[model samples]
Target: MHVTFPGRHGADPARAVDGVDLDIRPGEIVALVGESGCGKTTLARSLLGLVPPTAGRVTFGGKPLGYSSRALKAYRKRVQLVLQDPSGSLNPRHTVYDAVAEGLRIHGYGGDEQEAVAQALSRAGLRPPERFFLRYPHELSGGQRQRVVIAGALVLEPELIVADEPVASLDASVRGEILALLLRLRAELGLSALVVTHDLGLAWNIADRVAVMYLGRIVETGEVERVLTAPQHPYTRALLSVLPEAPGDPVVLTGEPPDPSRIPSGCRFHARCQILASGEAERAGVADACRGEDLPLLDGGGRAQVACHWARAVRT
Candidate 1:
């Protein structure tokens, strides 16, 4: 889906999310990997109905998402957002019980509120749920606070969870626990998730599939094992190259990321692509295409795909 915003003053509009197609299957997790300003969060917001796409449509269960108040309310019940920071997500005045129950209250759930809250908390790994009911945010550890955030999303029993950097704020010791909790939740609840993160390691740990984003588009996508082990897109390779586990020197990309409002001609990533810089595109006979021909969108699908003219030439 596409989501563009009006430009500041008289400049071109910022194409926050341009021509992106992604799908999430039930009981599966898909990680969106990209730099900070590459429109990962905008895509997440669009999926959750927070921002209406300026050009394309968002579909859920084969139906177009509606923007009406009632429609959005119903949609939100089945899809929830897990923010990056738990401290900011939870209120200092609210106790764990109140925090988790808030979704039920807003949705006007007719079931047993206390029971639902307890069950949600239990699912999020906060065992002996009742013991923490009265505890406030300040009393909880970083991991516990995050669990509470997860519990709040779970309280509504959502079909999908859009977690934006869920463990980015936690200590290295606690990151694994939270990641494990997410995996456990999917296994037990049959929940689907769209995890937006910049960390390839996080994707390796939790996602079944990975979609690499560049500018406002998805440049490459495939099964996690395939994409991580043998990346095709230049951007994806550069990102994985910088990983602590990567071999040799990292492929340090030159120049700043292109501005969305003035996205370059041909491939948006061509400006800083290592393949183009190292004459690989020229060797593959697609150097001109790399600078002049825009490639098709690499729609998230079963098979691996890369939106790069050079890669396409070399593969063919």
Candidate 2:
């Protein structure tokens, strides 16, 4: 899917999601990783048809997404969203059964509602299902609430789930459990998922592939092992450098990312890129390209793709 959003106010219309091209194959788990406000959520929301793209198109099974209510409703049945916060997502007054069954009701599923709800709850790891049907959101633990949220998505039996920070609100142990559950669901049901998260650890834990977003653009992408172990983009390297398991001096960035409305020319990351600032790019003879020419994501003819001229010149 390719997605872009218009800039707000009268500022320059820098795309919240620039000209990005990404794909999630069947049964694949692709993590969209970045710092906060890097437009990972916007890209994820576009997949769910929540935020329509100002430019570019999102296609499902080769068909372009439509804006009609009926078209959107049908599309939603196939693609579901699991929000960052279960507490904020779930209605306090609604019971577990109501929350899970709402999608079925909206889609007018004629199947047995009780059985459908039970199966969804079971699939989400809320074992036995019946025990939690009458319970409210406030009564459930953080993990359980997240499970309930997943169950709600499961009720639609979607082929793809766009999870925005699915485990960010849970305890450390619970985060693992929830991630494990997502993995199990993919294994059992062949479900494809687009997980939006800032945690590289989470990407390393569950994603089959990782796309590192920087200021609304994917700077680096590849198989999880390749991208995390040998990141090409300086932004990606800086991110991995901070991990406890990484062996080396940390590559701390010097400045904040530029505002979306006021994005820099050429490489969006050049302003804070240590490689360019340290003269490595100049020594490599790619400084002019890094500072003047827009670098599109270039496939390395291997497992990884990167969008920086310096990364291409130095690593390839």
Candidate 3:
């Protein structure tokens, strides 16, 4: 899907999601990585039809997404969303059963609602699902509540799920359990997921592919190991350099990312890119190109696609 959102105001960023093209193959998990405000969530919401794109198109199952109520309802059944915060997402008054059964009710599930709800909860790992049926959101632990949220999405038996920072709010240990649950569910159900997160470690833990977003566009994309271990874009490299287990001296980005409203000309990352400022590109005789021309993500015909002049030159 390709998605873009119009600027909030004349002076605000023109597009929250700017000409980003991303694909999630069947049963594949793709992690969308970026700093806060890089439009990761915007792109994810577009897929769910929550955020309407001002430009570009979103197609699922070879069909363009439709905005009509009937169309959206059907689309939602095939593509569910697991939001970042369960507390904010689930209603305090709703019991665990109600939470999971709500989707079934909305979709007019006429057969055995109890059995369907129980199965969804069980699949999400809320063991002895009957035991939690009457429990409200407050009664469950953070992990359990998140499981309930996942259970809600599962009730519809969606083919694809858009998980926006699914584990960001959980404790470190619980984070692993949730991620493991996602993996287990995918393996068993053949579910494709688009995980939006700022946590690169999460990508390393669960995603098959990683797409690094900067400002509003994808700066790099590739297999999980290749993108995390050998990032091609300067922005991606800087993000990895700060990982606790990263080897060698860290590549510290010197300044905050540019304001989306006032994005720099040419390469959006040039102002903060260490490679562009390091004089290596000058020695390689590509400094002018880095500063004078915008670069698109070039497929390296390997495991990665990168959008930086210096990286492309070196790879070629």
Best by lDDT: 1
* TM per candidate: 0.99, 0.96, 0.95
lDDT by residue (130-186, candidate 1, tens digit) is 999999999999999999999999999999999999999999999999999999999
Per-residue lDDT of 92 in model 2: 100
Task: Quantify all predictions' global Cα lDDT against the true fold.
Answer: 0.93, 0.90, 0.88
In terms of lDDT, the poorest run of 10 residues in model 3 is 1-10
Model 3 off-target regions past 4 Å?
A: 1-9, 297-303
> Model 2, range 180-231, lDDT digits (tens) per residue?
9999999999999999999999999999999999988888899999999888
True-structure lDDT of candidate 2: 0.90
Model 3 agreement with the true structure over 140-180: per-residue lDDT tens digits: 89999999999999999999999999999999989999999
Between candidates 1 and 2, which one is better according to lDDT?
Answer: 1
Query: Residue 199: error of model 2 in Å?
Result: 0.6
| Model 3 global lDDT (CA atoms, 0 to 1) | 0.88
Clashing pairs in 1: none
